[model samples]
Structure formats: structure tokens, C-alpha cells
Target: MASMKFACIVIMCFAVVGAPIAQAISCGQVGNNLKPCLRYIMSFWGSVPGLCCDGVKTVMAHVQNTADKRATCNCLKSMVAKIGFVPWRAKSIPRECGVVLPYEISTSINCDKLEL
Candidate 1:
């Protein structure tokens, strides 16, 4: 029983700690708007592509919780500015799943990783 209580406390602490970090990640792109990876890809190479931001928007449109939804929106928007594209394929990333990609896009995007 004592160990269970300690574990519960630890879990609660982690949850509290994580909430702000998630907020911080989403804060950077607040209101910047997302760019479609398709258009962004073309734009990088050069073209007046129509709104490609839709792809990411559609991917995340269902996120509930007004604040978290906004934060996640920011995260998606950030993806566009940083890489000029969205590479995640999926919009909202869960804590458990890994992002899979065929290419090594380290320098292309997130060359400067914020200290996590």
C-alpha cells in the first residue's frame, strides 16, 4: 500500500511537469498558421502552390480541449516555418507512438532542437 501511494505521487508529479512542457512546445507557433507539406515542398524548390496547410489542419481538426487544441495547432504551424513543410504525416502525436519517416531530415527541419 505504501509503495502504491508513492507510485501514484510520482505519476502525478510527472503529469504536472509534462503539462507545461507540452504548452511550451505549442507556444512557439501560436497563430503563425500551418503550411501544407505539399505546397511547402513545392515552395522550397519554387512555386505558387495553393494552401497546403490544410493537410495538417485536417489531421488535427478533431483535437479537443480548447487550450490543448490551440497548442497543438501551434505545434503544426511551427512545423511549417521550421521546415517549410510538415513531415509528420500525422498531425497530433501521442506520447507513446514513434514518428516514422523514410528520410533522414535532421538538417532539413529542426536543425536547432530546443532543449527538452
Candidate 2:
């Protein structure tokens, strides 16, 4: 019984500590990765720059799970809204990078509607 209780405590501790780190990994670092894509996302360019595509690919690669993906998507949407990035242009970034995201990238996207 004592061993079982100790194991449960350890599990709980890991759960508590892991969630924030996981969210940070998905949401927090997105802006820095996306910085390279700013100009491409903001205005008409002949084509997305190599650095922008690389950043898009890197951002997509970080989403390891449904929750993380949703969080990352929401973070991207919010950031786009704040930065005045064109929705269609922002939507094209992942595709331009050959990264297929599960949902459309739009400021109006509802994160809860995303499929896991």
C-alpha cells in the first residue's frame, strides 16, 4: 500500500510538472520560430523565403500531440490576429513549406473544433 501510494504521488508530480512544459514547448516558442516568416505572412511576396518555410516546418514539427497541436494552432491564430497577418497568406505558410497541418490557419478558427 505504501509503495502504491508513493508511485501515485510520483505520477501526480510528473503530471503537474509536465503539462506547463508541454504547453510552453508548443505555444511559447512559436513566435520566435515564426519571426522569420513575418514579412511573408504580412504582405505579398513573389514567394515565401526559404527561412520562412523552414520556420513553418520547424513550428509544425514541435506539435507532438492533439493538445499541443491545438494549443499551437490557437497560439498562431492569436498571434496572427495581433500582428495583422492576412489569414489566407498565413494559411499558405505551412503548405508552402510542404507541411500539412490538420486544420486551416485562421484568426477566427475555433481551437475546440479541431479533431484530435
Candidate 3:
């Protein structure tokens, strides 16, 4: 009975501890991380800010799976559409920041089809 109780406690601990890891990346997180890059993304010609690169790297680091990538992509697309940024400037952000993204950053990108 003691062993069974311990096992139950272990299981409950895993359920509680692992829940956040299994949860999908939220748009709020995506927005917060990418917010610093807006100025660079909007400008026609200028150096990418260090803060912007840091933000990009931070967001990319959080993408643990395809679902997270898709969620981030969708969030980015929605943000771009609403804010109206230069497409090429936005697409170049990852490269300028020394981060290689699997998908291009564009509003037309189909987030549902994103893969790891």
C-alpha cells in the first residue's frame, strides 16, 4: 500500500510538472518575444538591432516542436497583417539576426503546413 501510494504521488507529480511542457506556445509569448524586432522589420534600410536578434533567438529557442512553430508562425502572420511591415525586411530578419528559420516570415505563409 505504501509503494502504491508513492507511485500515485509520483504520477501526480509528473502530471502537474509536465503539463506546462506539453502545452502549446501561446501567442502572447510569441508577441512579447518578437516585439523588439518590429522597428527593424518596419524599416526600409537599417542594421538589425541587437535587441531584435536577441528577441528572435529567444522566440526560436522556445519552439520545441512543429506545433510551437506553427503557432509562432500564425501569430507572426497575424501580427504582420495587422501592423503592416515590409515583406522583404521581415523575411530577412532571421538571416540578419544569424538565425535560420525553416519557413519564411510572410503573411501568406500557410502555418498549418509548417514542419519541424
Candidate 4:
């Protein structure tokens, strides 16, 4: 009985600790995180903003799984299509911000096919 109780407590601890890690990544969250990069994306040539790099790093840190990655990719692709950012500028964002993305940022990227 004592062992069973200990196991249950352990399971509960894991559930509580892992709750935030399992939280879903939504498009709204992605958009809000990346919003600071809009000025850099729209510019023809300029230094990447501190806030934009911070946002990029934040987004990258939050993306902890394949699902989160795919969702982020899809959200970015849709944003790029709608906002009409310069292709090269958009592609340079991760490197400029010192964040190494798993895949290239582009409208043509196959988000559904991304792997962890």
C-alpha cells in the first residue's frame, strides 16, 4: 500500500510539472511573439531590432515539439503570404537574431511535413 501511494504521488508530481510543457502553441501566440519583427521584415536594409531578436528567441524556446514547430511554421508561412515581406529578409531573420531554426522560413515550406 505504501509503494502504491508513492507511485501515485510521483505520477501526480509529473502531471503537475509537465502541464505547462504540454500547453498547445496557438497561431495567435506565434503572431503576437513575432509582431516585433514586422519593422525589420518590412525594411529593405537595417539592423535587426533587439525586441525582435528577443521575440524570436522566445518563440524558439517555447517550441518544444514537432507539433509546436509545425504550427509555428504554418503560422509564419501564412503571415508571410498575407503581409508580403521580402523573401530574403524573412529568410535571414533567424540567423540575424542568432536563433537557429530547424527549417527555413519561407512561404513554400511544407509545414505539415516537418519532423522533430
TM-score of each prediction: 0.26, 0.73, 0.79, 0.80
Candidate 2: give the clashing pairs: none
Better of 1 and 4 by lDDT: 4
Q: Rank the candidates by TM-score, best first.
A: 4, 3, 2, 1
TM-score: model 4 vs. ground truth: 0.80
Question: 28-80, model 3: which lDDT tens digit per residue?
Answer: 98888888888878878787888888988988888889888999899998999
Tens-place lDDT per residue, model 4, 3-114, is 9999999999988887554576688988888898898888797878888888888888878888889988998889888986877887898898888999887889999999
Deviation (Å) of 47 in candidate 4: 1.1
For model 4, what is the C-alpha lDDT against the true structure?
A: 0.85
Which model scores highest in lDDT?
Answer: 3
Candidate 2 deviant stretches above 4 angstroms? 1-26
Segments of candidate 1 deviating more than 4 angstroms: 1-36, 40-54, 85-116
- Candidate 2's residue-wise lDDT over 16-96, tens digit each? 888564333556578887788888778876677888788777787777877777888899888887886766787887778
- Residue 82, model 3: lDDT of 93
The candidate that wins on TM-score is 4
